[model samples]
Target: MKALLLAGGLGTRLRPLTENLPKPMALVGNKPWLEHLIVHLKQQGIGDFVLAVKHYADVIKKRLGDGSSLGVRIEYAIEEDLLGTAGAIKNAEDLLSDRFLVVNSDIIHEISIIPLLEFHRNHNGLVTIGLTEVEDPSQYGVVELDMSGRILRFVEKPNKHEAPSRFINAGIYVMEKEALQWIPKHKEVSIERETFPLLIEKNIGVYGKTINGYWMDMGTKNRYRQLHWDLLDGKFTLPLKEKEQGKGIWLGRNTEIGPGVLLVPPVLIGDEVHIGERSVIGPYAVIGDHCELGRHVRCSETIMWDKCKVHDSTQLNNCIFGYGLEVGSRHILHEAVMNRAVGVIQG
Candidate 1:
């Protein structure tokens, strides 16, 4: 099966991080976020991929390159201007198979695609949207479905009082090639707002299948950090090249641990990491590759990207450090996020 990954968003919500890298390329568990999704899809037996790219498209191309290393055949669909979800898929119509899976690259979830495909095929629908129940329906595009599982209405970000259901569109879909015909060419269109509603009005088959599993949209900094915490806490397992040093603790090759250093469980330390004496790290911490940590430093619930250097006597809690950052001595950083360009430390 072929999959169309919508990865073109500018990631405005994840500012400093996205400023340097695309959302899909954002580091999660010391690997690109998109890599996890691709690996998941590949495990499910999907091979060919069409990546709809816009923001920092070249960087993604360079990083993923022909997808050979990933064991998938990848094709790029570059959009010159901002194209909404359906519009982006329409732009890549030429690369799409007769029936394909469309997934939003920003989301991390455990839902299986096999059942979704079966549901789509059984219903013979033009488009079948994956729906999941959320506590707050106001933040998502809620879907109202008939008893037969056919979509009756689409409400985009409804108010709490106005919401008709708790089930929201999960940003995953199975679509037949004919579904692309509904999307107009050379135009910005939203599948939720325009295409799906138009199909419903025209009496075309647009179905909704409720899926049960862990699902999160890693579009915000807090959620991004939480994803790491979840991984370490065993909410889900991600494939890592590093060896498991202990329960909930993974260490890469040549990682050094100094005398009197305390490594709490649920920590991931990357390659060539050096932890100084008497330093306490993690209950949930992700130390990226080539990081140098000084003595008496304390880090908890933090994510430090590659090549970061933390000076002695620094304390970081609930912090995120981007690539190549250098911290001054005696700094106590709590609930902070720092990146390269905007050096202004945020809490």
Candidate 2:
């Protein structure tokens, strides 16, 4: 089945990280955020991908290529203008056949789509959305479903007092071809704001499937940091192979751990990462690909993205460093999320 990846958003909330790259291209683990979503969908038998691109469209296409490397056929729906979610999908209607999946590339989730699709097919629903319980439903589009899973209402970011239910839209959906008919072509429209409510009003079979899985919206620095911590803690499963006989360590391909380093378990070190001698890492740390960790550095619950360099005596705790950042020797960074470039400091 084809999947529509909504990758066109400006990602204003992600800030400096999004300033240079699109949110989908942000490093979440070792690869770009979009890569994980694509891989996950591919594993679920949804291979053909249509990425709706806007900001940095060329970059996304350059990085992902034809998706053949991941065993999927990839296509692009370049949005010349900023289109809303419904508009983006409507633009790609010609490419979509049968029941297809829709997802936001910015969110991180491990939703099992098979059951969701099954429910949609069995009920012959116009749309089936993936819903999950959240502590704060007010922050998301609150969904109310009947006993039979038919959506009673779609409340967009309701206040706590006005919330119909705790189940919120997971930004993942299985859409029947008929649902696209509601969306007008070349117009800015949101599925939540326009199409979903319209479907409910028309008594169309717009329903939801509640899923209990590891799900996170990495829209902020705090959420992004927590995602990496969860990954290191083995809270979620990936398709990649695990490291043998290592406690709390998920080493990706070609990673090198230096000697005399005190590594506490639950640390995820990605491919080609170099942890220098006498460095103390973890108790919830995530080191991304090609990182250069200098000697005698102490890090606790820190996340360093790809190609970052942390020099000697730099103590990092509860911090998240974006890709290509540099920390000089003898510097101590605590509880910080650094996204911009840093100049070298000579002691």
Instruction: Enumerate residue pairs that collide in model 1.
Output: none
| TM-score for all models, in order of appearance | 0.97, 0.92
Q: Which sections of candidate 1 miss by over 4 Å? A: none
* Residue-level error in angstroms, candidate 2, position 256: 4.1
The candidate 2 region of ten consecutive residues with least summed lDDT is: 338-347
- Model 2, residue 143: distance off in Å is 1.6
Report lDDT (Cα) of residue 46, candidate 1. Answer: 94
Q: In terms of lDDT, which candidate is strongest? A: 1
When summed lDDT is taken over every stretch of 10 residues in candidate 1, the lowest stretch is 338-347
Score candidate 2 by lDDT: 0.83
lDDT, candidate 2, 207-245, per-residue tens: 899876889988987888788777766687655443634
Q: Which stretches of candidate 2 lie above 4 Å from their native place?
A: 159-162, 241-245, 252-256, 340-347
